[model samples]
Target: MAGSTKTKAKKPTVKKPSANKAAEASHNGAAHAFAPEPGDFRRYFDSGHTHESLGITPETLLDMYRNMLLQRRFEERAAQMYGRQKIAGFLHLYIGQEAVSVGSVWGTRPDDPIITAYRDHGLALARGMSPNAGMAELYGKIDGCSRGKGGSMHFFDVDKSFYGGHGIVGGQIPVGVGMAFAMKYKETGGCCLTYFGDGAINQGAFHEAANLASLYKLPVLLIVENNEYAMGTAVHRASAEPDLYKQAYAYDMKGAIVDGMDLFEVYHAMQELADEAREGKPALVEVRTYRYRGHSMSDPQKYRTKEELEAKKDEDPILRVKKYLLDNELATIEKLDDLDESVKAEVMAAVEFAENSPVPEIETMYEDIYTQSDYPFLV
Candidate 1:
């Protein structure tokens, strides 16, 4: 035994993919063999964007369009309030990624668990959080969803089934997995939509949660809002492979790349995969959207060119929906204008309400942070 003396056996090291397999995978587009394109994907699902897709009612289309508009308007109003110093704190606007939230939320069932990053005002609005309540929260007013405890990045509405406006980049991934685990354990037949940005995808939490979620075949939809730039750092600069969708292959799960600017595409893709997830399979969807606003309100345009930003803005999600509605004769310009006016008025009311709303009393601060009986004793 002494002579055998602690020689650690060399573990077999698997080689990287050979040139042949890499070429084949390249020819095949991805390891999964089903990377959706704009055209093929457009015709594949019946999400009511066109007459060909199934289960698309007129009401659903209208609802989707309306929700997209509402989110866009809400953010625009928030930006104005932020500029006026009415809303304080770091405000991350989801100006262009409206489709990701609107489509994804609409794709899932009402009672399903929804968790997202700090750019969650859109998700909250899409999930039926009142604009007034959401804006009020951004203003740190008591009438806000978190009762004024959470500012822009911490809106939590329990009744609406939205988990939180989580501040940490990849922190919510496990929370979503846990939610899915609950659904699986209870056989609830529901799914949890865990959304984070492209930047967070590189975090260890993302990989670990993805591994566990796939290993257990939990009903979880891990969606990446790959908006090109991770807070001013482009995906190419930050990652070896900017294709965030393919990152799911590490977990042996299917992933899809989608045009995040296209609401119908976002909605249909999410709907398809969410239905699959409910059947006890996990999935990853990377939405290739862009943000028109800076990483936060305080950011200056030092990273990219204005031309680039303007180009991306031309493909805006709200504008796309508006065009689709007009092209299909779903709504007239007057109708759209009226809707805009109504939304603007609603946003105005939110501002007025937030201004009048009281801030949390000093004593109330000690209450929400912890629910334990010994909290007072410790304090």
Candidate 2:
């Protein structure tokens, strides 16, 4: 790590939200649109001032904007490395969905548990994991949080309480519920944020896990990141009802639709839900977000058109946050530019560390596949 000098799972019983109840509840909310009401969401596009009008402090807005920019830059760097062939395997970049992760993660305490799908680089960074450590994982270096075996999809750090970067589509759902159950059973003041994509909504696991969480009133937040596409397949083409938040009715829990592109809106929604979960109630949040990149690094995007992509770019979450900061004079252009440069340097440092760090020793591969290890496991 001389080049940079930078810092830094599990399958459980699977459950699905009950179909009969979900179906019944889904119909009840059908009469209402999932879009947030007038005051439910705060828009930054046309606003000259933020935080004050939104009842949040200038410090909070700056903090949220900084976090979102970090995520945006982190993913951008990951994509660049993937292009250079420095990173291998599947790479799911969270380019346009920064607000969802940054905002939601900010709402949780240091001791709270957070779990999500394979797109976890941003989540890790938001939870205080360094860019150097995350990039090192992508490069398969021993210094990675997982000792380099997990790559981009499995960056687990028990000390920080990030459960994992689960590779399976909906696999983390039940695990999130179980973590919540453990917290309740052991009387720990912790909750789990289980995140997955809209594509995974149809998975039987979601229905089952959701039902259990609600029935038990476990301290968990079921976050469905409705980014409109599941691996290049649009939701309209796949889902019967694209309003993902409506599924919450089946579990008899609270549900809300948040503007995933706006950090303020996402923060407000996540804060409220986290409170509900802590009070021994389960809830669901459908973050209506969009991913600027393909489902993964290799996607050619034949499924959609450039015009549509450009249109969505107009709603860039990072830009919205930045504009809000400037308009309110919370941060000046010089400060933001300095911040951008700092992040870029941080990312470059991480890449250098990953390129220079040692790969895991060959002999170590014989260890850690099971509860008990044998030397020949590598062979």
Candidate 3:
């Protein structure tokens, strides 16, 4: 009876996609049934941009990686200092959003005015702000970019053309519009990068700024750094049309979305949009990113689960670029390590400099506050 038994059935074999590709099955599944699916998070220009197309060399790639690592290390150190109470007030650490800052900054010129919300340290540092000045500012010392007055929320460097660290949620949007209008007025042939969080995008200032930018064809790239949550609320709960880039169409402006975790995607998209903006074609770019840290040092971050954070880490922008470099054979492991070591040393030196810096004199506090005109008035 056993010898006459039927044969066993074999299991079905299915093909697997690359790490950079989402599951074809899910992507091709029912539209309403879609959920967050994984593959390559970066949506590169023309599907994927090559070094030849982007005109970048091994050194350039290495430099980008170095900047990202530097930002990461600097923030990590800043967190330690904050825990130790070296940095007072609100300390919003840009732990996972380095790519959006570094890549977008690189996509534009040094003279292109850059402005953003209070989470400003990353943007400032990426736009060539010295680590010493940045760290000193956090320490509330006189050597800080804003000279101990602005604290962690406001960092300014006129030379770098980084306008500020604006504290009022969407306030910087109007300032960016003014900057763009000036560029258009003077025919300066420059663009402005105005960045705000998903929460800030809902404010009146952002809408008004968008209208003015589009109406006058101002050279402004309005960027919404959508990191999923605004304070404690998810994006869906805040904005009706969560597709923020599409908001550009309301003002008759061009719009696009870039994966902020993908450095290549961010850089290329920013570059293209910036170039277009320089030609007086204002655009709104939604840079989808994630912040591993809480909204601020004070936040408990109970909105999301631990599994979500861990899963997102797998899409770390730094690791993404590193993998690209290694896979392409463009750089050796030692070279990358050396780059990282150099950055670490640099950040350490900045911390040392910040520690040694002196606090501003009480008398100097009232100096930048008021000025007198040459009027013949008796004291």
Candidate 4:
């Protein structure tokens, strides 16, 4: 009995995924996408390139850099606010993945429907949501975008066509498809940008949504913000197809992967996908990004090493744009420093606004509830 033998089953090998117009076959099993593995993402977006080359004006580039700074400073302040217990419930920071949202948004129109996962504050800010309203929402005050009802994970702005800050993993995937369907039906040339983390790729919802979007030729861009980790689990360990965008092949949808650390790469990739999506071609894009903080406030983050984080910091999206601006001579050091100071002041004011804003009134709860015929107290 001790000498009895059993054979192990062979595992299928999947070559890593690549980016751009169409998927390409690899020679010698190499990936077309150069990102987290390369350690030198800046080489592709070399110091020689200018904002004009990227089709953005000098002032617009400055604005993009400023927005990135706003996101970083906002998230930093939000962390402090959470620590003080001024903000309650869960708080997920978007410190390191600003480019994925900002760059993707830059490639699309303001009217395009934007929906994303619970890590939403940065996207909201990038899309022009005021810091005061955003911080107020975190503080659960009446001035919040959701009237303080949605909290951190449910920042919604109908005016901006930003549908939600969805809480459930993979829940927003189907909803995004539906939004795209509506866009197509209305004959609106807008492409719906559906954002989710790497964690949501395997969900049945994503697969089902992708099938429908591809089958009907919906105008939807399924953007997977592959931040290396889905909560605590690394992408490779959790996913059978670790190169997440390749999952699009199942539905015959086009897919591309980008160096999420580089804003130019993200923007250019997203711009191409958006053009296709608006023409009724469903697509998937994996913005390979990273989050510096733990998955959420409660996470201890014992999974990763401090050295790994320090190395990632070298590719910081905010610094990338700042470098481009300075190196291109579009902005001076004093100008950039002043921009930082102004952004700092703006964040501080948002904190003050949240502190002073009043909590939501009880009657409003009865008002938003769909089942209500009349307010219970009023009745």
| The candidate that achieves the highest lDDT relative to the unseen native structure | 3
| Candidates' C-alpha lDDT | 0.84, 0.82, 0.88, 0.87
What would the TM-score be for candidate 3 when compared with the true structure?
0.86
Q: Which stretches of candidate 4 lie over 4 Å from their true place?
A: 1-49, 372-379
Score residue 101 of candidate 1 by CA lDDT: 85
List of clashing residue pairs for candidate 2 = 15-208, 15-209, 16-207, 16-208, 16-209, 17-207, 17-208
| Steric overlap count per candidate | 2, 7, 2, 0
Q: 1 or 2: which has the higher lDDT? A: 1
Q: Model 3, 47-72: lDDT tens per residue?
A: 58766678878788777888889889
lDDT of 1 by residue, 252-356 (tens): 776777878887787788888888888877888888889988999988968999999989988988887788789888889998899888878888888889999
All candidates' TM-scores? 0.86, 0.84, 0.86, 0.86
